[model samples]
Each structure stands twice: as C-alpha cells, then as structure tokens.
Target: MHRFLIPKELKILVETARRSCLKKPDLFRRGGYHRDLQEIRWLLDNVESWNAESRISSVSAYSILEAIVLFFDCLPDSLFPSQLYSTIMDASKSFKNSLEIYNCLPEINANVFVYLITFLKLVHSHSSENDTDLPLFADTFADVLIKPPAALSLSQIPKSDRDSKRKFLGYFLANDVSHLFQIDLLLTRDEYPLLARHLVRTGTN
Candidate 1:
C-alpha cells in the first residue's frame, strides 16, 4: 500500500482556496459558502496524504478535516462550475486508491471511508432535483468505492472515530469533480473549529 503524501495538484488547490479566502474574508463572514467550498475542495484534494500513516498526526488530520467542514458550511452556490471542482474530484480518487493499499490500519481506513461516504452524500444532496438518479449514483459510488464496514455505524462512532471518518471522507470526496460544481447543504458550526485549526497547522507545516 502506498502511504499518503500531499500531492502537488492538491497544493495548488489549497493555494486557490487561500487566495479566495484572502480576497473576500468578509464574504465568508457574511454567509458566503463559496469561499468555504474552495477551502473544502483543497482539503479533500489532500485528504489521503493527511490520512496516510506518516501523516496521521491528530493535529494534521483534524486541521484538514476541520477546514473541509467549515468550508462546506460557508460555501455559496455561485462558486459552482468553477474549475476547482474537477481538481478536487481527481485528487480524491487518486488518494482513495493509495488508501486501499494500506487497509490494515483500521483507524485510518475507517476514518477515510467515512469521509468519502460523506462526500458522496454531499454530492447527492447538492445535485439538481432535475438530475436523474443522482442519489442512486451516489449510492452506487459508495457501494463500489467505499464498502463501509458493518461494525461502523457513523452515528455510533466516538468523537475520534467521527473525526477520522470525516477526515478520510473529505479527502475521498474532493476527488469527485462534481462536488466542486454544485451546492447541497452547508457545514455546521459544530464542525468548524477543529478543521480550521487543522488548516492553520497545515499551512505552517
């Protein structure tokens, strides 16, 4: 199994998100979810690296996952169709393949799987109502790509488990270019701070 490492493409995505955030911090403050979307795109793009064994420090993982949720909560619809979506999806798939190589680490595997599942859910939720069988597509993607564990009910997982799941899923989802192109639901405040801290740490390191 290949270990996770931040990819060059994902680094570019993060830079774009940071630029967007700098360009309009107030937009994010005033409920502009687009800025948040950019940030999520960046985090998800690099989730595999963040979840990789060598990279599995709590601070780093939390920082990346927290950014994803925060950006998700704050992003607006106008950002859809941006090129960033395609980048996120491509990166996510690449990382997912790397993760599959090292499934022995249940903690990492579980967390990454949940993050991917969440991304699929977000995609399903965000797709246009007119789009045919979007939900079915999401389920199908999860079935084939994720194969969630029977012992792991997301709701029943502890905070650490939930955090790991979110982190992994965030990376997995970012690979789906469609996520970059649509808006489903905003992330909750409860999910923000943790990810934000992760973002800060990632930036510095």
Candidate 2:
C-alpha cells in the first residue's frame, strides 16, 4: 500500500480540535452538532493546505486519527440535540470516507477503524430515551487503544517504532481514560466500571 503524507500543521490542528472538545466541552454547544459540522467543514476546506512539507510519518497519521476519534467521543450529548445525531454521524462518515483516498501505509489498523465505525453507527441510530450507552463508547475507545485487537506485522514500521507506538498507546489510554472518567462523573454522574477496570490495569502496568 502506498503511504500518504500528513502535514505537521494538520496534525496539530487535529490535536487542537481534541483539546477544544475535551478541555472546553461547551465550545461546540452553542450550535450543537452543527458546530462540529463547522469544524469538519473547516478541516475539509483546509485539506488543500496539508502539503508534503515536513510530512508526518504514517504512525503519526494513525495517532492523529485516534485523536479525532477521541474528540468525537468526548462530545457531550447534552450539547447536541437529538435531531442532529444523524447529521453528526453523516459528517463523521463522510470524513472517514475521505480518508479512503489515501491508503494507510503498510497496513490499516482494522480494530481502530472498526471500533470507531461501530461507535458512530450505534450513536447515529440509537432511539432509546435514556442515553445510558454514552460511556460505553468511551470505554470501548480506551479499550481499542490499550489493547488493539491485532498487531499486524508491517515492514514499513520498524520494531522500535512499533514498541514506541505501543508505549504511547498505553500512556494515552492510562491518562486519558482516567481524565475522561472524572469528566463524565462530574458532567453526567454516569457509572463507568469499564473505565475503572482499565485504570487499574493501567496502574498495574
């Protein structure tokens, strides 16, 4: 598979988006999910600016995508109206569809892609009055990162980089999951036993 270059600026922009969503959950609340649509629209408009100057590695691209997933996962349901769910899901689907233009170098992490797709599909289609499954998506996200379903042997990624990537995932899952748990408890008072389990596992490691 051919590798696609990800610009440093684009990566930083994605991280910024994540931070905006997490650190300031209300940033997109004014317009609801449409605010997210605006963010995606802006990214699409700037897609042309993601040139090959000081391009990022393929692994970094995957990390950036993971951050995007985190960004969406962090979005609060209270801030988004029920009617906008489909719009948000459609926007996310379109964004993922755009990613298909560039082959994920060496190999695509099927686990990550599948988990994100499933999370989005469930959220987009759910009709229950109570949104009990909100934390489930966050838990599943942390699970996917901490223990990726399968690690494919890829020639493009060196052993050292692979090990580093694993370490990074572990670190991210450990800190991010705990932080998310606190946020959820404070914001929604939701119980997330999965988050607790992962935190213990992370602590043990």
Clashing pairs in 2: none
Segments of candidate 1 deviating more than 4 angstroms: 1-66, 69-102, 129-197, 201-205
My TM-score estimates for the predictions, one after another, are 0.22, 0.23
RMSD of 2: 20.7
- Which residue runs does candidate 2 get wrong by more than 4 Å? 1-12, 18-22, 25-32, 46-67, 70-172, 175-205
Cand. 2 TM to true fold: 0.23
lDDT of 2 by residue, 2-29 (tens): 2222223323434343332233222211
lDDT of 1 by residue, 1-205 (tens): 3222222322333333332332321211132234433444444445554343223222223233334333322322111112222233333344664344324333322333344344434434434531323334332232223322444466753444323333334444444433222222223324322222222222211
Instruction: Give me the candidate number with maximum lDDT.
Output: 1
Report the Cα lDDT for candidate 2: 0.29
lDDT for every model? 0.33, 0.29
